[model samples]
Target: MAGDRALLRQALSTGEETDGRVEFKERLSREVHLSEARFESLAAQLRHRVLSGDGEATYVVGVTDEGHVAGIKPDAFSESMDVLNLIADEAGAHLDAVETWGTKDGIVGVATVKDGGTLEIATDHLIVGTAGHVDHGKSTLVGSLVTGRPDDGEGGMRSYLDVKPHEIERGLSADLSYGVYGFDDAGPVRVDKPDRKSDRATVVESADRVVSFVDTVGHEPWLSTTIRGLLGQKLDYGLLTVAADDGPTETTREHLGVLLATDLPTIVAITKTDLVSAAETDAVQRDVERLLRQAGRSPLSIARHGTDAALDEIGDGVVPIVRTSAITMDGLSTLDTLFEQLPKTAAAGGEFRMYIDRTYRITGVGPVASGTIESGTVAAGDSLLVGPVQEGTFEEAEVRSIEMHYHRVDRAEAGRIVGIALKGIEETDLERGMALVPKSADPTPTRRFKAEVMVLNHPTRIHTGYEPVVHLETVSEAARFEPLDGQLLPGDSGETEIEFKFNPYLIEPGQQFVFREGQSKGVGTVTQCIE
Candidate 1:
């Protein structure tokens, strides 16, 4: 993807002429003086350009039609983009992204436009979360897959994903990391330099469809962080990694249980196959299959029945297993094919809802909140409420701008991770687990709820007033539980009333939650919301 972008940039630098899919413009025309007929003509041309690119097109601003890079000033470039946006709106398209570069003459930039309805396709966008035990090669596999590079047999590829300096120094990931790759008409467009943020942005802009991986910690001490990554994000699929040498460990079972609890369709990858012989790999595979059966999952090896059968029945209690080795690049292509063809199961058709996972403040952009659009759609200028603050109240906020994968967009739909610039709010007022909902929702914060919980593990029976940390979406808080049926024991299913200890949260009925304290764990679904 980086190579493709460089080629386009070089062509523009050398004064490439305008074409159907690529247009060059020295400046934009003022719309105030244009007649209706002229405006209609311009709109028609813009529509043609978008259609020529199969729902996407590029416009090179500050360039001449006759192949001249006559760069314009920054102020002039901004105005030109304003006009271009108007043109796109008139043509029923939107400016999806923009990038600029400074030249000796002036400033030049590229604008990507796409038809409004094309982004709703499920296969075009997908999110997969990675989970497994420590040193199981989770990060290494993801790094190799996204960068198309093999490891140096000593964790060379994992460096691309380790975000914090401590993690790099410790040779393990201690926090959640993100990596992405995309698919074009030709196939997957992997990152040449996975460590470069710019290269990732380029891949997001150029690919026809994208797949985002949420890499979570695999160590036992950071299990809470791993749980947050799984249950908080609106994930479409799960990629569970297991080392061929270690087979299935206690941590592997724990992570797998969380993935299954969230009802996310999952695929298992047996890593480090090169270090073990075929018999050892086979033994590990059998152990994984036996573990899956113990958890009520049907295991289907992709090597035997192929990807078609696994893809067809993955979400229906069937888990696909693929053998891979980062050093040898074995089974990477199969993994790519599976991801490319996997159908999205998360639906985004309800009223607008987004759970805040993190917050940021940019120099000129003011306060920004980011999260996955849990349901429905949100656009710039829409009125929404953002809160459940420490005071347990909701505050009004307006969407100033929307961005996905560093690309500025007019709107975002469900199942997408986006950053939304906000108006009428301070960054300090927002917190994780707070929600952004439509003004019409008139949401109420909840302090207590009733849930049907199944105890997965506990040394003893749970009684009233037992406190455990409950994880729901992006929010994690300690809650006291009282069993509705006298008492609950391990492997028991019963009703319970739970109340948050401190702050209230925007919790909805039918939402799943995980409660854990030390070695004890339980899964539950909210049955009713008590205001």
Candidate 2:
């Protein structure tokens, strides 16, 4: 039964039998027994056996000589594909080495299941985040850091496609909103002011790094995207902005929901400080401390505020807050000083990684993928394996072009939002969960994942093997999360070692995902993959 060439060849080489035709000859006996019915059954059995991990090594030597016939019904191509699909699955889950060959003589198959290799280590932080409630002055703080001003003019209405403040305010149709600034490794310590006092913006560049200070939508509905953007890259320190005058609100609380989840270090910026009196500033500081305590942070916890007392309180890991009137140009230096003190990103480019947080096709160019460089360096023509695992399958992809910002370049370093033109990948293949990786890493496609999730809203119950939309980077997909542990209730922080039925894509560990309710509709990240 095992020596059956027809069945063995079909499953191994082409993954399907040749349309009800089983040709064979008996060399030694001079009489061939062609059992077509037997061949059909044998072929199915052979495919099942190979997928079931039965034989160590099998080969179809040749046909015997005498031709014979036995009647048997054949299956459709789709049905045969199902069998091959099973084989591909088994190969991914277990087998390390396998090959199949078909020749005029017959078919041949070879397989050796060996131990898998370790994934590539990331040299830089994969993702970072910034959060403050709606109108919490998140945009103002980002503007102050990048443009050296407090008022970005239109506030949250800045345009993503156009970098100019005026153009952005005019509602320019662009995919992203953020100003890109490149700096040298030496650092930009000096802070200047923008000409338009109304805009209150200044930009200074130094060396080795580029900061595109992004002012994203801080509203609750956009919170998922805000978190998604922050989760897409590893950060130096997460900056949380709060207006001294507005204090804490419900929206601010929602911002805190995402902040407290990750282990990343954070800075608290008290904007609109000049709007209130000195005593009121101190009181606002106190209120911030109280809010921090309520959110599980200690009041005595050192947060960056603009004052010697606040700085002293922060000690080495200080939370120095600066009081800045984007109008008066005061405290701009303090902001610069804070940025200078920011910890550099972990190492530099090591492993090749980029999470596509945003992507679009330029008017002339075809398809482009954009996201912060998670790790390693990417140059033009360098092959990048990009895709995500959804519903327990790995969808493969490749990048055609890689660029920094809008400029056409051969390659880009980690820690920047790169726009890449993917070759051979259509718009369908590119999604938010997808991550670019080096060719060395053996990609694993899985649908089940074990993770630790802190429920943001109440009534939190993610059912076992329940399918939800997983949002990571710029990719989103319908994925099922099967809990290895029991049900997780709201505010109940526990570990669920569940199987992730991800879409057919490859996702690495340490990537952040937000879960939503439906296909390409929800948000979430996979915290762990248990195999």
Index of the highest-TM-score prediction:
1
What TM-score would candidate 2 get against the native? 0.61
lDDT against the true structure, per candidate, is 0.85, 0.48
Candidate 2 lDDT, tens digit per residue, 1-531? 122345444533433233322222111110111244544454454344444434321222223322222211112211222232233233332222223333443333333322221111222212234567655555555545555444545553222223556545644312235443333455552234322221211121123334455444566555556656555555555667777788777656655545555544555667677678878878877887777767666443233423445434442333444555554556655545544445454445478877767656532124677777777787655666666533443444555445443333445666655678665556655666577787676667655565655555544476666566565555555665555565655555556554434354455466555665521222234676645
Q: How much does each candidate deviate from the true structure in C-alpha RMSD? A: 6.6, 19.4
For candidate 1, write residues 324-401 as lDDT tens digits. 999999989999999888888788799999998889875324478988889999997799998887688789998867
The per-residue C-alpha lDDT of model 1 at residue 369 equals: 92
Query: Count of backbone clashes for each model?
Result: 0, 81
Model 1: which ten-residue window has the lowest total lDDT? 116-125
